[model samples]
Target: MLTMIVADDEPFIRKSLIHVFNWQEEFGIEIIGEASDGQEAYELCMERQPDILFTDIMMPMMGGLEVAEKLKAGNCRARIIIISGAQDFSYAQSALKMNAEGYILKPVKLPELREVFHEAVTRLRQEKDHQLNFEQLRKQVQSNMPLLREKFLQNWLAGLYRDEGELWDKIGYFQLPFKRGDVLTAGVLQLDDYQSAIDKFSEEYRQLLYFSIQNMITECLEKPPGGISFVASENEFIVIFCPDQAAAPGTGAISSLCEEIIGSIKKYLRLDASIGIGRACSSASELEDSYKEALAALVHTFYTGHGSILYIKDIQPGTAALQSTFFYKFQARLMNELKAGHTQQVLELLEKLFDRLAAPKLQIDYVQSICAEIIFTSARALYELDEDIEQVLEDRLTIMDTLYRQKNISGLKTCMLSLFYNLSTHVAGKNTSKNSKTINRIRAIVQEGYARELSIARIAEEVFLTPNYISLIFKKETGETLTDYITKIRIGKAKELLHTTDLKIMEISERVGYENPHYFSTVFKKNVGVHPLKYRSGK
Candidate 1:
């Protein structure tokens, strides 16, 4: 059962909440405690150690935001959610900095409460699972050599199965050869024109493309003579072929078989895929080398363009020189951007620059250098800030570099964005830069007007700036015009209300910054190409 604590200043409000929720019947939630103010809530939370905390923004002794900040500073495990009657989202934004789990406004509906409760429980479950996984893997590393243990832990965290016994069990039925004269051949499949495909993709379509790729990989290895594993989290597949040897004719036979597999994969998957083969290494213990070579072969996917089978020998190394301070220097630049609250610019620059590494002719060692540079940059930034991500990034990129060795454009995109998201979060948490504080204050005012009365004059007055100057600065920093962005935000809110609530059209209009229902309808149709009613109906 999950334990919950609810905090509010008003007795009537507290009573209403206790009545609204059936702690025992509706959910497996137990009302462990209640408090009349933020200070009391904090005390109760420390004493009771509830799984979730529902806190109001305003209180007499301390505000909920302060309580949340204190809890996060102490590394409290309880998930927090802010409840407030005010439409001023700046408080909620502050709560977000403290890692508050969710924000809900006044006039809280029962369904909304339930949704928040569900989210809190889900987060709790995730944290528990992660802790358990970490503990299990941590114990396994203690007895091994320090360097090997570090490498093994890093691999496991990157979704690579480090337990040879566990990995072999999965392929036990296939019974791959354990002896010498057997061969090992791996194929690298790259999504050839994924950039073009992504340009035409919606979020749902992009997910479909990934799932399709996963299915295609699975299809290719179903009954192969080798033992294959698709580590999708790492975006790479591994096939350990065991048959004949180099002293024999196994390498040639295995290469030919890989070509045949490529043809069959093309006939089916249909999304412009290509394959590359790594040189066959001597022993299973040398799987890492063969894996690297196989991935190096995938780099051919970019040059061969779309759907060509590239053997490892076809491409050669382009350069021997490496940038001495690539990772640390680049992260220094990125950290500066993020610290300045230039999140959008930071995102754009990382994406743009990292894509330059997607070349057709890089050798295995050069490819490793490219991946090392990016991972090193990320790791250096996190480590300098005292984060606990030592070796995690290096291991993940080690796997990702293999998947992208062929310069698989689509695969490269997946890896970069994932890295960027991680990079942004790390910076945001440690940002000591005070520069964006005032701008964020102003931006908060702008965000609150979507479903209510607002104007440049009103917002500027609150921020103590003239309307024209405010608009100019906002555009200079955020890249969107004030009026245009307000319209966009209001329309987005209107759509959300239309889908999530039973509020009538006029009410929805009034809620999202429009005084006149007719004007709201007009803008809705103009922006969404449909009347509000039609949108709600579709949902």
Candidate 2:
């Protein structure tokens, strides 16, 4: 299919080049037409789009070099092959500059033709590959549209783009479908004890968090909240409604909705979640204003304090209440303390942040982020030291990300207490200067039979402490209530047996402290999605 045209001022030379190739045997070149001059060759080249072109250097009316240059300048899509007599050396440089793939001597040989033919095929393959890469990049950008779009917009705002025109081009390329004057409303979510939860649970638990957030947000949002299309990013969702639309998430209604969301998520998911609603904007271009306001309100929970819904309306924009700079400052001070091996100072800062988050109105979702930030930042500092703490930090990140899924603060807090206690005693113990013998003994007892038939009453007796005191210290040190901690450990053990052993559900249930398989199934389904049997079956 390598169709081609031959061009030369002298008709004989043009025919001779055409006849040089055997048409099928040597090069499989089809001489679609012959041109006697550059003008005719240029016309023919444009019309046919031959796979290759062969032209002569010395021509009367129009030279082969001019024809090739004109085609290249016009952006014609043909690979050119120049045919020159042996002494026409001057034309070689011009042909090369014109981007001719090759130049052949007159009285062309068959071996040379074959080499040129293969060369042309190689060039064509390169072009094909370039096209494919562009196509794939386009597809990938589309698939990760929300995340990529957000990142791109952040960059555009942060001076990553050269100009507004460049920004406009990217917006078009991403197909955001936003124009000026379009309205957008957004939602903010925060994980209450995210850091401690992560350190406490593995990634399997984090996936639950993603589900938790989705379920809580989906209640009234299922119907689009009227004017906007829903767009979800990592921990946030923006419902892009219309400026002139029939309805909006009424300022008061949305705030109340956030409160209801907190209650529902807590009831079903066991997560402590705090949400903030931002004012609606008249244009997509003005979304940055709404987004900034929402974020300010979210952070406001820290100083105005946390644990409940904070609406932009309830709180004044500027300085009505003095901002407590503690949380903001703790990150740096804690990291600095951890670095100097100042264990006492580090623990004090950690507790301070923890206490601030525990304020009566603190939402579990936001608190988790605070905890996650505290943990992740600490772990990251450890990472900087080249410490092998990836497994720990990654789990905490997942925990932070998944705080939305916990059905109750009680469960989340229990999980937090266990993990934080272990982290303090075992992981970061070297940094601590003082330790109590009772806490040391309690830690030892929990470790010994955490996966067995453990209970607050049983463990308290085993550790020579009253059950009530045991529960209090456990919650204070680790953040989890004793019962939930024991159940999570037991269920975790059951999960391992289900995956690695041939034990039946009843057998696994008995093995993990549950006497009745039916109760075990109920608990398992509540914690994990499928029934115990289905889990064992790998379904």
Candidate 3:
């Protein structure tokens, strides 16, 4: 609420000003004080620091003009209104010079007083809004700087900056501690079996887990002086360590730092990680080469196994590549066995493939690449039979994750054997009483998901059949339309709840898959010969 003081020598005038209108109720203005003279008005304003002041132009002891001048000298912010009994132009000019809000002669009108007060209130609210908006914008800019910095760093690691001038400009803009000739090194860290580990969690939970992992890494890097960490991919994080010296640290110090980070993740998050450190470079621009070396070292996890810190210097070069003829021969025989639903033959073929992969000096990446192709082949086989691989194999999303998590040929063979076995059963099941099986699948879906949306398209998607085909089979096998069956199931559940529980009608409606309570009542009455309330009351 805005506050004001009325200052006038005449008692009648002061009382009239105070009681003329419902200022507090209508304009939200409170009369904090009534001063009988200019001295009292100045004192009251200084004491209370009211939002507004009203005073007479002529009064005893001092005048309103002197009060306004003294208040202005004191840097007061109140809106001043000057009252006078004269129509002289000089008094009006003086009021304007003093920046008084108004000059009124003896009698005051309600409309004039309301207009001035409303303008003051509107101005105050606008100023408040402006201040609030500015503060919010300032906070948003401050919070987004880290994200912007991370983007610049990611691009730098990707070798996106070609010009030295531009690279230096960004380094300065992001306030990176590295100078032109500083030595820099890179390390890549990856959460072992990341997707398989979090496959059961919701998407939001996975994001929170990743955020916590990043925070832990950031805290671990605090002692290393100039290490900066940022996410490089879904399961990978990159750290660029810039040591403040002419030469890079010894390999022992770098190894210890990486080991510390890896140990922290394992101990606190209960997750294993591997770190691959690259050789140090002499300048920031050469850091991209270091990044590539780090990634190369990381991929050796396919050979060295998880939770092992590998350095580029420790890697032994290999000259072996997969023979094209052997790879294609296995792929062809495996695809045919998979399509024919021959479980035994598929397992035999997988064993042969693993034996070949276990050969020494074989390219590790080529081993994983061959396994990835085999997984896709299984999915394609299901597709050829007009079935969704996801529905046929419940672990479709985790299949690739499992493949990538394998650290040796034996683990990869086990994951593939399981996938092909499931696919084989589904393929051979097509020879049974297909329509009856479809009916059973439809009923099971409705039974388990009754409280969810149960449209025919949704059920068809779950069973990997067309909506029309499922509807026809359901009617043929059960002697009832699918829609009527769903309704019957819902109404039956609703009736049971009405009789056995004291749940509200709306709550029962939702429990039985009805979203609208009114619609639920109508359907309930039609099915049971009474409204839900009457049915509940045993009337």
Candidate 4:
């Protein structure tokens, strides 16, 4: 309800104004206070902060004009009406200059008073609505602030802000705790096995867990002056620290904070985290370099194992000292072993190559480049052996994408080994000239019936061999079992249909020879490294 106050020197005038109308019934206003002078009315207005004030233009000690001037100076938002006599006309004009709402002369007219009251009520309602709208908009922007900050930081670290002046401007606007000359250090924290952690909780609880992790990191990092944390991605966070000028460079405080974050997350969230810290950089424009160093150090978690902190300074020397010739020799040897079908030897060489690549100082981009070289080299070798490398790898883009997404060294190793073994097996098939006729006939029948119901027994019937004998010969000739070959063919067809057609999964499953769509989905995920729907969505 709207609240009001009244002030006048005469008691009869005050009583008459109070009873001037049934205010509560006509205007829904509650007369909260009454005073005998303008001084008393100003005090009541300050104390009550009423929505409206009614006062006489001329009064003892303090007049209505003085009250209006004082309230306007104090930034009071109340609507004001001045009551005056003919001699107080000049004072009433002065009150209007102070933004008073209306002027009611002595011997007030009831209709005029009612009309002024209605207008005041309408203005008050509109003001209240505007305030409510502004409050709601403020709350929404506050809630989305973190996401917006993350986007800004992502763009900043990507070197999108090329001009130093513009970068500093944005830094100030975002309230980052760095100036032009301050040295900045970057650190990245990534949850190990983040997907597995999400899988352990219900869908509804996943975001809660992420929030808890973010809060824990914030609590640890924000305790130090000039330290701030931002979400870099869903499972990754970036912490930036600018040590005080009085402190020495590479102070231990940042390292201690990182350790605290690791311990807190493990203690509270029961999750492991890997932290990679970059060397100190002397300017805001160079923060992107520091961020890249931190990420490079973080990716070493794949080699060092999780739940540990790595610093770029400690690992930078090893990467700098690495010889290019060593990598070249390793690649040559890996190709030879793959061509010879020496699986054990190839695995050993791969492990050593990964160990070398996993040096904490090595950047993720360099690692990806080396891995890509190995993939292309292997693909070329398999192509030279008359195998359709595209068919063997399924899709080159999909394979490389999966390789790049590997979170740890082990994941990368597993993906590379899978590709290498598949290529090796295909290359081995070229050496089976002695049994070409038998293998060719079995292959033809299997290829022809891949979309229909066919099995080992049926294939053996067509080949005039026992089911067991057919399986053995197929394995010897193709380096994969008959069942494995058939499954690969069916999955390849399913992938094609998924990419090219809008057919539902069940229809695709039936078309690919699987009667149960659920089983087809399971098998598809096993081979593609993602669920059918997710793969189709390109996630």
Candidate 5:
């Protein structure tokens, strides 16, 4: 319902205006208040914020034009209709300049008053609808804001956006906390043994558990100067901290915040987490560097163990000297242990290797590189044992995947030990009769025809064996699938070409039996840590 206020200095004029029409019945507007002077009318407008105001041009204390000017200056949204005489018609024109709705001259005609009031009502209804629509749109955008921000941040960090102007425009549109030059520190919080922690719960409860952990982190970070935290991946949460200028916290304070988050998660969620805080960068554009630093620090959790805070500043530089000699010796010993089918010896060697790599002097990348070397060495040993490395590790819970997932040295040790145990058992059970000959034949076929579209059935036809029997015996003796062995051979060939030849990546892909260069690059990156070009560049 529309509400209105009436004002004029003449008491009879005011009374007559009110009595001239049954406002509610004729115009669907109610006279909420009556004022004898413009001053009273302005005060009523200020108090009630009515939809419409009807006032005279000439009045004592304050005139209708002054009221209109004051309301306009104050940015009042009310519709104003002027009541004026011939002499006051010019004043009414001034009110119209102030955006008054309409003018009803002295001896106000009822029909003109009703018509003006109807127009005001129509406008008000239109504005109400527009406002409602605007509000709904605002709410919808707000609801999807988190997802949108995550996508933006993910792309921004991936270097997908290069335009600074567009970046700032998005930042403002999203109302992100930090401005262009504000310093931001990237921090990552990873739930220790995330899969094991939430495995027992249903999907709904698992989400609840994640939400609880998020809330705990938010609460801890928001203590005076807060930061923005979002789930960067399934097991990791990314936090961007732009310290409050008035109460800028030190690195120690950030450490304390991480400690608080850890403690809170333990208390509330009964879960352990490791937080890695990156060194501060001067702007959002440099967030990717900070994010990489934070991730590097987080990787240290495998060495340092979970339930601890790691700052990038505390990580030491790795020596290439140690990686060359020490890691090589370690890998050789580990491979020897695995080849001998000594499960306990292999486990013990893994422990020692981890302990050596866990030294505070080693860089996170150095540690990761050592771990990758261990995996490659194990793969080579399995190959030597006539074992299929791919089938053994094809559970998707590969050493590299575990290296990313495991939270501590113990977790890493468990995963490696499990793989070694499986390898030992498979080796111990290998038959040296027809199965070995069949597996050798399969491996030969893969080694020779890896660059072709080789399938188990095709190889079976060439070897005069059933596809099913070939598959069974091959897995039993080799510990890997035929497809995986072929991939390993093709990837090895691709790598050799990448390093030894000047062939374009497309030619290399064709040579490796991959028709698509993009697919070839993806497989190359998954198997080898870098893209084909980067690997070729020796990065």
Candidate 6:
């Protein structure tokens, strides 16, 4: 709703104009003030700043034209409408000069008044909408400023800029709290097993998770003066800390801050993270050196393990223990144990190999090479027995991919153990007549639980074999696929139920493990040449 003011020298005219229309009901305008002279009208309009104003052209003290001119100059927001009995063309010209909304002859017609008032209200609404849109746009820009600053920080740390002047310009533009010679320490924080940790989320949700992690880290780092944090990569965040005092923050301060960040993530996100701190540097230009050092320190996690706070100053490289001769000797023994189907000896040898690899903190490249040799040699044992690696390992297609994805020693150990155990199962199953026993066990499980959700994988778990291995043995022994066997069992049961009892089709379908009666009917028709109801009726 809009407010309005009416000004006329005569009291009758003022009252008539006020009552000319039900202003609030018809136009959403309420008469706020009444003025008898041009001076009064100008003052009222200035004070109230009404949305619509109506004034007589001729008045005492000041004319309506003078009032309108002064109001325009004063930046009053009211929409001015001129009313005059004069036939002078100059009055309308002057009214337009002052940007009056409309000019009307003395006796106002309701149609003209309504049209002019409606136009003013519409114009005001458009201006108001524009103001609101501008406010929203301003707020969006403000929110994105932080993202812009983060991108700049990421580029700067990557040594993208060579000019010191350009670097300082950006630093000042981002309002970074660093000066020319501030002592800076950089740290890199990484999520443990980042691939496995966030593999369950979609790409969009992964970004949201990253945002949550960064927020937690930022809160934990708020205590360090002039510390700026930004995401350095998919699974890593970097923090550069500058102490407000002359002395730089020691390793203790950095460790405590990193510990807080790790604890917060664990407590809230139920995730583990590790941090690597670099040595302090003297200037902004040396930040890349410190950052690289931080990354170098972080790689030692393969030896130190996850959830560790490693500092560059504290890292001491260990002696190399396992040479090429040692690996060759171990690999030969492992192959013999695997080929002989000595499952226990194979596992014991695996433990021994890892034990040797564990000591002396070997380089990741050396460790990966040895692990690859172990996998291939063990896989060769399976191949000699005419068994497929796909039948022995779950992720056979991406075994090497999975190996490299291991972030630390523990995860790699787990992956290798899983691989060796599955291979051992196949080797042990091969030597013994477990294939016959596996078929019997699968038949017994299916005969008893055919009415439940039975899958080849689930049956394989019960019989200590992979789904592919069990499926292969079952097909070889029974002359049918495992799925066909299960379906045959279900159909045979349905036939017995149909012949022996007078039960509903849906009931028979459920008893035979078919959840949808229509699907059960379809399968029954396809298998037995008739539907269950027709079969029961001996059609």
Most accurate candidate by lDDT = 6
lDDT of every predicted structure (CA atoms) = 0.65, 0.64, 0.79, 0.80, 0.77, 0.82
Candidate 3 structure quality by residue, lDDT tens digits, 163-262 = 8889989999888877787778898898876667788889998788789878877887777545788997778789887673213334555666777888
Indicate whether candidate 3 or candidate 6 has the larger lDDT.
6
The global Cα lDDT (0 to 1) of model 5 is 0.77
Pairs in steric clash, model 6? none
Clashes of each: 9, 41, 0, 0, 2, 0
Give Cα distance to truth, residue 519, candidate 4, Å: 73
lDDT of 5 at 94: 87
Taking all chains together, the TM-score of candidate 6 against the true structure is 0.51
lDDT of each residue in 1-539, candidate 4, tens digit only: 88999898999999999998889998889999999988898888988999899888888878888888888888887788888886545666686688888887767888888888898788888898999999999898778877777787888888788788998898887777777877788888988878876787886687787778888888886676448887877877888887732133245777677778899989988889988888787767777898899887876776677887888776644344347799788877776666655667777898888777666446665677678878887788757655565677756688678877777777887888787777767655644563578789888887789989988999989877667656755776679999999999999999999999999999999999999999999999998889888888993
lDDT of each residue in 1-539, candidate 2, tens digit only: 56778778777766766676577665556788888878888999998888777777767667888888888888788788887885656678888888888888867787886798678766766786897898999888778997777677665433456554555568677676555545555556665655653567667766676666665566655442333223244445443333332233334445555666677767776766666556676544455555566666675554443346655655554312213586667666665555434445556665565555544545445665555556666676666643655544447546665554444444445555544444444334533322245456666766677646666788778767567655655654567777777677678888899889888888888888788899999998888888977887873
Clash pairs detected, candidate 5: 388-478, 391-480
Instruction: Give per-residue CA lDDT, model 6, range 461-517, as digits (tens).
Output: 998766766776677567899999999999999999999988888999999899999
TM-score of 5: 0.58
The candidate scoring highest on TM-score is 5
- Report the error of model 4 at residue 97, Å: 3.4
The digit string of per-residue lDDT tens for model 1 on 1-539 reads 77889899999888788778787676677888999988898888888888888888888898988888777776676788888888886776787787787888889988988898777777777787898899888777554544453344235324476455664553342343344444555555656555664677688976776666656555544544544444333234444455532222225545554555556556765556566566665444445565667677676555456666566665676763335576456666665564333557677866755445553444444554565556556566557645655423547556565555534455555676666566655555434342155457666776775666888888778877557645655665667777877888889988989999999999998988899999999999999999999999998
Q: What are the TM-scores, per candidate, against the unseen true structure?
A: 0.28, 0.40, 0.42, 0.58, 0.58, 0.51
Query: Which regions in candidate 1 have their CA more than 4 angstroms from the true location?
Result: 1-181, 202-208, 222-224, 233-235, 244-257, 319-539
Winner on TM-score (5 vs 6) = 5
Model 5 per-residue lDDT at 100: 84
